[model samples]
Target chain A: MPQPVIAAVGSSPVGRTDFPGRDLFSLALEEAFEGLPDPAELADAVYVGNQSEQYEHQIMHGTLLAEWAGLRNVPAERVEGCAAAGALALRHAAKDVRNGEHEGVLACGVEKMTAGGTGGATDALSAAFDRAIEQRSGVTAPSQYALLAQRYLHETDATEEDLAEIAVKNHRNAAKNPRAQFSDEIDTDTVLESPPVAPPLKLYDCAPVGDGAAVALVTTAAVADELGVPWVTVAGTGTAANNIAVAERNMTEIEGAAVAAESAYEEAGLEPEDVDVAEVHDAFTVSEALLSEAAGFAPTGYGYQSYLPPESREAGWTDVSLSPSGGLKARGHPIGATGILQAIEAYEQLTGVAGDRAVPGAETALLLNEGGVADAVTVAHVLTAGTEVAR
Target chain B: MSGEDRLDVDSPLTLPGFFSALADGDLLAGVCADCGEVLLPPRPACYGCGSRNVDVEPQPKTGEIYSYTAVHTPPPALEDDAPYTIAVVELDSGGRLTGRVDANYDAVGIGDPVELGTRALTDEERSLALEHELEWPLHVFEPV
Candidate 1:
């Protein structure tokens, strides 16, 4: 079977801004479709990810975004698993193309979190937890992650400086990304001194709440070949779920991410050593440390040491560059927009369009996305240049 | 309760009203009738067997801290009560619950055995409003 290829990608400039009650999903859909090479073109199917209907106060957002994007006649479906919504949408689009159900598909992710204010938004996101056991007990997102960070610190030799290094590196990378929410170059001291949202996890250590959207145009290799457009083939896709309660799993490890990454690597017929660039979810500083180990980029409980010194970017150990797109920590996590944005970053790096932040001579890229305190779900995918799927 | 005491009441409730009835002196969770899986926080369906046939029954409140964290800055509503410890207590019945740690900052650690204690009522309006009650009751966990 022919693999699905990403043909073109688009996104709204991610940052704090005013939309004046404009439906966020609608704005993102319009932004994605406008100024494309072919405006009137329609997709065979569409997939979207949304978390809280009560927060957005809009139900059936899949149809809303589809209609707003002029894809009113296509089949559209919505998938939700907290932050993984966007990645799950892409997985659906990939499945449709892989199954020959659609010649081409559109996967879009958008979230309007600023609508309800920060406290309300936090409450809504917290609903992803076990309502009866966790959230009902008042364990918010930061607190849940803080527990993981605490355990990680206790088990490993990693320190607050190690996590600050990740924030520094990603922030430097975001400085070159025009759409990132925090593009300023920050040092370790700044991150260390930032107000503590959760102990050992400072304000700078967490991804900000922002409103934005991202979209990707995917098609079968045959369709891309006929269109004469550049593309990246989806070589592998994997997903896994853990216990909804964070306390149920090992706080020092992200077992689900490890499972997902191994599956993706196997499906792609590639090893961790073969990846040239990666964009792992860094929803929080500790998340990057845990995910890097789980994804096999570093030894278990030692990923905090993987932070390549800024000077080392020119000569980093293990040539595979990571998070050249600033990642969630610096790139502004607009929730639903995150997964698609990761794909966009991967596409840019693979195509050498990432400007100064581009990983030199990049060809293969991996993306890891997780949702809800590392408890709900995780998805990973490997992408290779051209029409040839990795094998 | 004094004004300060009311302010201290902004913590989260350890269990739902139904389960609160259990912690109030009874212990209860929905047990899967089909697979016999015990569900905490009491769900209507059995996650183990995907069966809706379940029975709410009393269970042991004894558990251990699977993991924990000492929160220095509480949520905005609980700001007055900054610097508290919260932990995930793994029940002997194979369930997990999160609540305030009964240990001081230097005393708590992961994997420590814990048992359920009485809930502390808070007066914070938002916290009270969330429980839809006049007071917010926070579950206390002690080292077993």
Candidate 2:
């Protein structure tokens, strides 16, 4: 079957902002309808992906967003898979098109975080874990990932310096992305000298908490052709889940992302070598190295090694062109909206519209979105600008 | 305020039983009777095998830290306890539990031996919980 194609993509700038009277759904609607000729007349269904309703004090956002966006009575619902909620929603919308359920589906993710300060936001994000157990022990996002980083460093030859390089590299990339939350470049000395949030995880190691939304319009291949809009084929998509508690699974292996990416690569009939540009979640600096290994881009115990210098591609170390959109590190993570943003980045890079940060002559792309600690729920997708499915 | 501020002790996995056992001088874990997989927080069912036949087994209190972090930034509820060490200790029974490790922040490291201990909620912590409408585990781990 011809797969669904992402017809259009849009997003709001990612940063820490207090948009006084604006609500979550409206933020989503504004970004979703951006640049569309007549967005109100184009959708058959809406899928809203959000991780925490506690942040906005609202629920049932799918129907709420659809109604607010002037979609009227069309089918609309929300899907949750923690941080990967947006990717999961996009996958569902794509399947809807592929199965002939809806010719077009609007998939978007939005999170309004400033309503609650760091404390409120931290508590809300904690909802992703096994609440009664994990949250009760004072394990917040940084603490959870800190454990993973400690274990990863202990077992591997990689050092904290390698992880710092990742932050430096991502910030450099984000400097070229106008929408990113952080664009300033810092060296390993700065990263190492930064205040420690969780031991081994300095302030620079974490993604900033921010408010944003990202949207993608997916439609049947026929509809995309008829609309005559610039689009990218959703060549493949896969998702998987893992134990909710960090203690239950192997800390070193990102089992969820591995499982999801394997299926995604297989379905796309492509391998790691075939990917030209890729974006993997890097909510924490450690996450980038962990996910790089999980996504098969780097050898086990050597994910951090890939980030080090030959120092440029001409140097000697392998040129792993990862996270060109700044990633969650410098780009900011608005939770629900993050996954869709990855899709938007994929669309931009593949379509040659990624401005200064664009990868030259990029063709094939991969996007990975992860949720919760060690990516308990992960979604992976492969995209191409080509009109036809090569497989 | 009395100890009445505690989390509901009746739920299947409220872990009140686990904390109660610690106060009674024992560490407990739920072991599946059919598959022999041990679970922390005492689940009603076996996650490894589809079996509801589970037993609350006494666990070895001492274990080596599998991983750890000295938390400098904490949630509002844990603000008072900022710079506390949180570690995931792999118990001798093979069940891992995430808990606070009562040690000097820079002194603790991965693989350090630790043992279960009960922590009476401080008046400040209790007030914070009351203020935030939060529930916290009333237990911790200490260097053994």
Candidate 2's displacement at residue A153, Å, is 0.9
Clashes of each: 3, 0
Task: TM-score for candidate 1, please give it.
Answer: 0.85
> What's model 2's interface RMSD, roughly to a tenth of an angstrom?
1.6
State the C-alpha lDDT per candidate.
0.76, 0.80
lDDT of 2 by residue, A1-391 (tens): 5588898877776776665213544664565556665556677799988888787787787887777667877888888987899998899998898888988888988887767988888888877776545666678898899999999999998788888989998999899887788879889999999999897899998988888887788887677677766689888899988889998888998988998988989988988767777888898898888887888877787787645542442222244478888889998888888989889888888777789988777778888898888668899998877553222
Clashing residue pairs found in predicted model 2:
none
Cα lDDT tens digits for candidate 1, A218-287: 8876766676656888889999998787765767889899899899899999988788888888988888
For model 2, state the Cα shift of residue A13 in Å: 1.6
DockQ of candidate 2 compared with the true complex: 0.54
Question: Taking candidate 1, what TM-score does its chain B reach relative to the real chain B?
Answer: 0.76
Residue B138 displacement in candidate 2 (angstroms): 1.9
TM-scores of chain A in all candidate models: 0.93, 0.93
> Which predicted model would earn the best TM-score?
2
